[model samples]
Target: MSEVPEAEVVFVVADLAGYTALTEAHGSKQAASVVTRYVELAQEALEPGTRLVERAGDELLIVADDAARALRVAARLRDAVEREPLFPTVRVGIHAGRALEQDGRYFGTPLNVAARVAAHARGGQILCTEEVRRLAGEPDDVEYRPVGPVRFKNVTDPIVIVEVVAGRRAGEPTAVDPVCRMLVRPETAPARLPFAGRTYHFCSFECARAFAERPEAYAEA
Candidate 1:
C-alpha cells in the first residue's frame, strides 16, 4: 500500500459559538445537521490553496494560502447566516502556517493554533495570529481591534487576537459607544453617534440614547 504524499499547507480552524447549549437543546441528530451545513457552506466557498480537511460534528478544518481570505470567507458566511436571524451566530479563527500532511491530510502545531484561535473568536468575528496578519496583508475591507493575548492549552506562548469587523462592510465609520468606548456593529447595534467628527457604531438604541444623555460621563482622553 502506498502512503499519502507528505506536503505542507496552510491551516484554518473555525467553530460555532455557544454550540454546546445548542447541542443539548437540539439533540445529537439535529445538531449534526446544523454543523454539517456549516462545513458544507465553508467547503463550497473555499478558494485556491484551500480545502476542507476535517469536520467533526461542530468543528471545521480548512487549508488556505492566505489568512486574510480565510477571515474574509468566514466573515461572509457568518454575515449570510446572520441576515436570516434563524441561524446561530458563528466565530472563525485563521492562521497562515505550514502544516505537515500525510495522505493529503494536514496536521501539526499550525493546525492547533488555528483551533485555539477559533476558540477565542466572538460571534460573527474572526481571530488571526500575528503571523497570519502579516501573511494575509492589511485587510481594508474590515476593521480590527486588539483582543490582547490569550492562553490556550498545549500552547507555550500567549496568542494575540484581532476582531474581524463584520457589522458593516462600509469603509465609513458607523457609531461609537461612549459607554463601551468602542465601535459597535451598526446592524446589531441600535444607535449611531458622532465623535471626533466621525460616526461610531453602538450595539443598541439604548446605548445611543445613553451616550447622548451624558457625553461627559464616558468622556475619552
Candidate 2:
C-alpha cells in the first residue's frame, strides 16, 4: 500500500450558532431552508484556492491553501450568512498544519484541532490556533484578540487561541451578544437588557438570561 501524501494546509470549520433554537422557533422546514441557503452561500464564498471539503448538518469544513485565505473565506461566509434576514450567525475555527491527504479527503491531528477550535467559538466569532495566527501574520482589516490557552477533548497539550474579527467597525450600528458573542443588529435583536448603566443586545432570550445570571463574566470592559 502506498503512503498517503502529507500536505500543509489551513482548515476551517464553521457552523451556524443557535441552530437548534432556530429550528424550534421557526419549525423544521424553515430550519432546513436556512441550512440550504447557508450551504449555497458557503459555496459562493469559496475563492479560487479554497475548497469546501464537506458539509454535515449546520457545519462546513473548508480547506484553504494558506491561513490568510482561510480567514478571508471564513469572514466572507460569516458576513454572507448574517446579511440574510433571520439567518443564524456563523462561528468559525481555523488552524494551519500538515494533514494526510487521500481520496480527496484529509485526515490527521490538524483536522481534529481545527474542529475543536471551532467548537470553542461563539456565534459571530472566528477563532484560530496560534499556528494559524503566526501563518496569517497581520492584516489591516482584521484584528486578532487573544483568548489565551484552551483545552480540548481528545487532544493533547493546550493550544493558544485567538479571535479574528474582520467585519464591522467600532462605530458600526451593531451589537455583540454578551453571552453568545453573536453579532446582532441593535434594532432587530430579540432581547435587550440594561447592566452597568449600559444596554446589551442579544439574539435570543436565552442569551439574555445567561448574561443576566452572570453579568460580570460576559460584560465588556
Candidate 3:
C-alpha cells in the first residue's frame, strides 16, 4: 500500500458527558439512541472540507484543513446539541498541528492533544489549544477566555487552554451546582470545585464534596 501523507490539520473531538450515568439512569438502548442522534447532528454541522474520522463510543473525532472552519463547525455542533433538550450536554476540544493520515485515519501528536483537551472540557463548553486560537484568529461576536495552562497525562510540558464562548447569554451570571442541581453565584457560592477545564460552584461544602466523590454522576444532572 502507498504511504499516506502527513499534513497540518485541525483536529476536533466532542464527547457526550454523563454517558455512563445516562445509560444507567435510562438503559443501554436509550443511551444508544442518544448517541445515534448525536452522530446525526454532527453530520449536519460539519463543513464541506471537514471529514468525520471516527466515533469512539460517545465521542466524535473530526478533521479539517482549515482551522477557522474547524472552529466554526465545532461551535455549530455544540449549538445544535444545545438546542435539543433530549440530548445530553457535549464538550468539544480543538487543536491544530501536523499529523499522519493513513487510510482515512489520523495519528500523532495533534490527535492525542485534541483528545486530552476534550477530556478537560466541562459539559456544554468548548475548549481548544492556543495554537488553534492563533490559527483561527479572532471571531466576531465570540468571546475567548484563557483558562491557564493544563497538564495532561503522558504529555510533557503544559498546554494553555482557551474557552470559546459564542452563544452564551450575557448578564445574570449563575452557575448550577453539579451535585445538588441548584443555581448559585460564583462569587457567593459557599464552595467551589475545579475539575477538568471548568470551575463548578456549589451551594454548600457538602454538595461540593459529593460532586468531588463521583463527578460523572452529576455531569448530566
Each prediction's TM-score versus the true structure: 0.67, 0.79, 0.76
Q: Tens digit of lDDT per residue, candidate 2, span 132-204?
A: 9999899768889999999998888999999998865333336667665445789888999999899999878
State each candidate's clash count: 8, 0, 0
Question: Residue 220 CA error for candidate 3 (Å)?
Answer: 11
lDDT for residue 67 in candidate 1, whole number 0-100? 68
Error of 3 at 51 (Å): 1.6
Show pairs that collide, candidate 3: none
lDDT of 1 by residue, 85-158 (tens): 22355677877665677766676787888888887876556777777766766776766777888889989988
Report every candidate's CA lDDT: 0.65, 0.84, 0.81
Report the lDDT of model 3 for residue 170.
31
Q: What is the lDDT of residue 218 in candidate 3?
A: 72
**Which one wins by lDDT: 1 or 3?**
3
The regions of model 2 sitting more than 4 angstroms off are 169-221
lDDT (tens digit, per residue) of candidate 3 on 1-221? 77777889899999987677567645789788889999999999988889888998999999988877888788888878766644566889999898997767888988999999998998778999999989888877567899999999999989999998776433333566665443356787889877877889875687778788988767642
Model 3 CA deviation exceeding 4 Å by range: 168-221
Ranking by TM-score: 2, 3, 1
**Model 1: runs farther than 4 Å from truth?**
1-8, 166-221
TM-score between model 3 and native: 0.76
